[model samples]
Target: MQGPAVFIDLTLEDQAQELRKYFKSLGAEISQEKSTKGIEDDLHKIIGVCDVCFKDGDPNEIDAILNSIVSIMVSIPLDRGENIILAFCEKLTKAPDIPLARVCLQSLWRLFNNLEPSSPLRYHVYYHLVQVAKQSGQVGDVFYGVDQLKSQFAQCPPSSEQMQKLYRVLHDVLKDTNSELSSKVMIELLGTYTDANASVAREDAMKCIVTALADPNTFLLDPLLSLKPVRFLEGELIHDLLSVFVSEKLPAYMKFYKEHKEFVNSQIGLNHEQNMKKMRLLTFMQLAESNPEMTFEQLQAELQISENEVEPFIIEVLKTKLVRARLDQANRKVHISSTMHRTFGIPQWQQLRDLLGEWKTNLNTVQDGMVKVAQAQVELTRKQKAAY
Candidate 1:
């Protein structure tokens, strides 16, 4: 099983068939969500059949199976239905060594090419497939499909309203370095994720994609640089992308852990890690534009606002909708909205002192006027008496 060509030795085909049967039995137990545990050991039982299939043994059979899988993957989305794609994805984990499993993936590959705005199954398949792809590190498949969907034609073409779900799915998943496809293809596809005409949704999607593409960890840096998608948007969006990317410990921070673990720890060390928490609070205040439904601890983690500082800020922000707290829980914290503007008004004590100063100045002026009036009155009285 070298390249896309899957080869089996003469002795192994029978066991492969029986193993396929066994895998189908396990299909009921498969879950679509990502798991922390490795799928390798779990898949070992299934792949072991391929081992039995090889006249040469497990290593050769496994190579053949992986090759078959890789080959079928490229073309499956063009022809398969959503149900079948799912069935195949579940089957792959249980039956990776079998031809039937490869066939399921193959059908799935073909089906992707058939997706369009008019296709009844387009969105359903797109949504499910993107998530499956993400979990399995098959982003290249979805990326290629999306690339083909974005019509660059001048004439009216299929709309990407269907793509909304796909983008949403991607937004939830952390972009893994291992899953990168052609960066050029990814950028081209992402261009359609946000239709600038849709306003809020468009803005959000654009912002997400911009952040994703600008992310230093995303595998397609050269592709992003080559396409320059971020520049096409307004500077603010690009800045946001940069800011978020940097705030996530920067792409180079991994290297820093190796080279400067002490330094990184020292930075977080001050105030016994409270400094980072305060930074998060500031971010919540400044960067979060949507509903900031944050817990007190989350607020603490995000805003680094001290317990003392939080109460005052919470009291102040309560006037706005951004802050909320439970009366019984003193740990309650404010959820900052992204749109809130900072107003650094004069200090309350300073205002009080200025008011007192003005009052004293006015009192002195009134006193001087009263004394003058009194002196005039006395002179008039004295003159009248003399005339008499």
Candidate 2:
């Protein structure tokens, strides 16, 4: 909303083209107004005056003004999705001023959520919408956005829906991998699950887990059945992304692509040689479960590779710490230790949990045995004194 509304009257068909300039200037500023107070002030002034265009004015004139604002929001993005939702929320003090924008936002959100997880929009709009919900500071709204995503994922078409959903979402997200943004948004959403949490994205993610797990046929029966669902999405998506990197068109940054190509020759069974590295990465992850202590060299040795070749490969594995290492300085061996396997290599948190629980149980058992042994010793001493 801009100009004196006098512009609305001129309607010089030729100059109508320039009318968009006013909205563009304001649209540029929209990303800067983050907080509610900031958005409210600008929105108030703009709408207060812009309302005139809508007041008893021609429908097309009204639409033109509003559409300019809408168009900017649609076209621009901080990463993906409209960059202006926070600004919208900031300035949305007047319910009447926002009805149309809110409607459009909701509709757009629904459309993105309904697409496959591998959908290009997932990396674009759906991903951004989650961030918007986080920025909105409204728990219900954040979760609502997340729910739309989870529901779409959960209701994936029968047979191959799960695979397709992951397929659609993973590529773009991997391509546009601004991991900082993804990590921040996920942290914010996860933190919001508590009463203090206002992010709607977090709440909705929780709801999806509850609903999806309840239906055994559609969703995979796995660890996601418990408190965490992200575990499933992360591992599956990563494995898929690795597959893409291993493709003939290797990503520009893959330094070891050639070696990875050679190493994967026979390790990956049916997973084509193109997908060999990916399969090995995941296969090694699978191996970690049983022999968590095994080193990359040990794994390479299992594949009958030279100790010299093993060193460079281990350097790569060392970066992720997927396998722990120890130097056999004298004999020159590296070991992984113990994997404690699962669908993927076990997450550290799970191990911490098991260790803590076992510690408590062991302490209790040790205390009980000590108490019984003390009593028996006391009685035995009493009998020995009497016999003497």
Candidate 3:
């Protein structure tokens, strides 16, 4: 009853002070073994107060109090610690703050390690630990995070929710571009991709890699290539990216595009020839942008293809709808109307620069012509005045 008034009538600072005093008194009673037995009867009341203070306390203050609580819980007998851990876990799940949740997970991890390996309550504790760890971005946090998840994954009857949770954790850990992904997690994902019994796990790992590559901000090679398993799949991975045209679109990926493209043609699948022609068509589209109207011979010369292949290839490119082009067989010329959105490279950048430069020069010329016309009219007016 008095708790509600203390929170409403007092400032946060005063409330903190009052709550600290109350917790100190409560904690002291826990250490007195004689009084501690009866303290169990008041555990609910003690937990309710701690929860409100934790929810309302300043971050630094909350951290300090949390440390104190963990220490106190550990110092108490195992039976008491179990109840305290359960209470804190319940409170945290209702409204989890990532940073505070991390502290709670650390405390929970300590308590969990003390329990028997076959304890039924361990699963409940492990589930919440994984949930908290999934939001962690650092490599160090991933060890416990992965451990808890892996244990749950190997349960007698595997759960789809656990599998989904595992994938979510992988995505978050790998996608944290700013943090260095721990080598353990990398190896785990690679092993899963190569040998998981369930196709979903393998597919999820592959999808995560594809996603990391698609992020323009992520430089995939430097960090990912460090792992030997991932290193061995370098060519395969690059080809996968190339198949999706990401290699051609992102300038960052272009550094390896040519080498990858050559490998695709020389050693990849039987559709190599068809794929090569499609790549040539993409290059031709870039060339056509700068020369909107070109004769079949000029197009052939620019593309390094014979004149006969030009019209047939142009027809193939038209079918893809990547470019809007018309073949004028009667006049031996091709006319391009527009191109679909394509990744810009150095060549495209140069083309845009040349176009802008020409426009600037044309604008200057128009300005000069206007100036001359203005001077001529002013001089004619002066001459008429002189004649008058």
Lowest lDDT sum, 10 consecutive residues, model 2, at 212-221
Off by over 4 Å in 2: 1-274, 286-298, 340-361, 369-388
> Of the pair 1 and 2, which is ahead by lDDT?
1
State which candidate has the highest TM-score: 3
For candidate 2, lDDT tens digit of each residue in 1-388? 1221112333232232343344335452222222344332343334333433433444455555644443333333324333244333333322233333343334335434343454433334443443333333332453333334456546332233332233223322421233233322333233333333233333334324322222212112133323232333344422233333322122321434354544333332222332444334445555555563555456664544566766665566565565565555365555566442334225657878899999999999999999999999999999999999
Q: Name the 10 consecutive residues with the lowest summed lDDT in model 3.
A: 1-10
Candidate 3 off by > 4 Å: 1-49, 58-61, 76-87, 93-170, 173-176, 179-187, 190-196, 215-388
lDDT per residue (tens digit) for residues 329-375 in model 1? 55464444333322223553576689799999999999999999999
Candidate lDDT values, in order: 0.43, 0.40, 0.53
RMSD (Cα, Å) for all candidates, in order, is: 24.1, 16.5, 16.2
Judged by whole-model lDDT over C-alpha atoms, candidate 3 comes out at: 0.53
TM per prediction: 0.28, 0.32, 0.34
Tell me the deviation in Å of residue 156 in model 3: 18
- In candidate 1, stretches whose alpha carbon ends up further than 4 angstroms from where it belongs are 1-104, 110-119, 151-159, 170-174, 178-199, 202-214, 217-388
Where is the poorest 10-residue window by lDDT in model 1? 219-228
Query: Pairs clashing in candidate 3?
Result: none
